[model samples]
Target: MPELPEVETIARGLAPVLRGRRVEAVWGSGLPLHLNRPVDLRALRAVAVGRTIRRVHRRGKYLLIEVEEAGAGIVVHLGMTGRLRVQPAEAPRAPHTHVVFTLDGGGELRFADARRFGWVAAGTPLAALAVLAALGPDPLSDLDAPRLRDLLAASRAPVKAFLLDQRRVAGLGNIYVAEALFRARIHPATPARRAASRAPALLDAIRAVLEGGIARRGTTLRDYVDADGNSGDNARALLVYGRQGGPCRRCGALIRRRVDGGRATFFCPKCQRR
Candidate 1:
């Protein structure tokens, strides 16, 4: 799944290309991929046609495209494995490109998903979207850290699991949580409140790790790519995200891997001693 950084990167890239450009039309596969309505590519065209894109924004992992003709927005969620690509309207369409929006500027924004887990829904306002309604504040914004600290302090879940809970801290996923825990020298298996005295530093670590990811475009461990079809460089700079048996960058201890909430977690056992 595209986490905060990857989604944010995509939103930023799409903003300039989409802003001020009108949606000329839309097309998509007729079958709904999941329990949701199969995107009637026609409905997309009807709602968006001639509506100029005002801005692109992100909340949690959801992408929002604001339209100018009405007080409305389109929400997109890139599930487990999905990709967004922008190509020339003349480019040959690729398989798995389920949704294509023809832009007024003669370009097409495509949504491709082999697993078909992603979704798109239109709404009157971004806030009324179901996903946005439940999502916590964005981590990139002025986060309520003291509130987060209180929340985590009350949970007995493993630190990593607690971080993965969107209600506690928005925008953290398995990848960044592992990286942040390693950066804070805290073990993924540690209880959330075990390091209460260092809560502030731990919070800072989370922010730093994600900010670093955004700065580097994001960590593309697998299929993630920006709108222009570019892979992220952060994966190359990762300290321990996918380095299961590699030496820890800071302590030289062998990086260890384990499963938490069915996700791989990498950490330095020695350095992250609880």
Candidate 2:
């Protein structure tokens, strides 16, 4: 899944290109797309066609495009394998391109998902959407050590699982969580409450890794890419997410991988002792 940094990067790449551009037409593949509600092609056209895009921003992992009309907006969630790009109308459409919004100036904003797990929701009052309503505070803008401490202290689940819960702290996925835990020197299996006392360190690590990811354009181990169809360069800078059996940079111990809740977590046993 494209996490916070990936979504934010896409939003940044899209803002300049989309702002002030009117949506001249809207087209869909007729194939069903996962929607926050039962929004059909007509509803999408009602909200998007002819409206100028006023802003493009990200909340958690969702990209929000606010339009000129009051209370109207478009929200997109780029699920695993999903990609959003802007190209000339004459450009060849990538395989699986599901939604296309023709802009006034010969440009088109396209959403393509090979696995069909992504969603597109359009209408008024974007906050009313279930997906956006269900998200917690964005870690980058709203989280702090004390706030994270209180959140962690209330959970009995493993710290990794707790962090992965979008309701508790939005925009984190397996990769960043593992990297954050390793940076904080907290074992993946440690109970959330037991990790509370180290929240300051953990919070710092989280911010560091997230900022680093944004700086590098996000980690692209596979399908993730910015709006320009460029792969992120952060993969090689990862500390422990996918380096199983590799030597730990902090300690000479070999890195390890363990699966819990069907997600793989990487850590250094010596550096991340419970």
Candidate of highest lDDT:
2
TM-scores of the models, in the order given: 0.92, 0.96
> For residues 154-195, what per-residue lDDT tens digits would candidate 2 score against the true structure?
999999999999989999888899889999999999999999
Q: Per-candidate RMSD vs. true structure?
A: 1.9, 1.6
What lDDT score is found at residue 229 in candidate 1? 82
lDDT of the structure predicted as candidate 2: 0.90
Residue runs of model 2 more than 4 Å from their true location after superposition? 35-39
TM-score of 1: 0.92
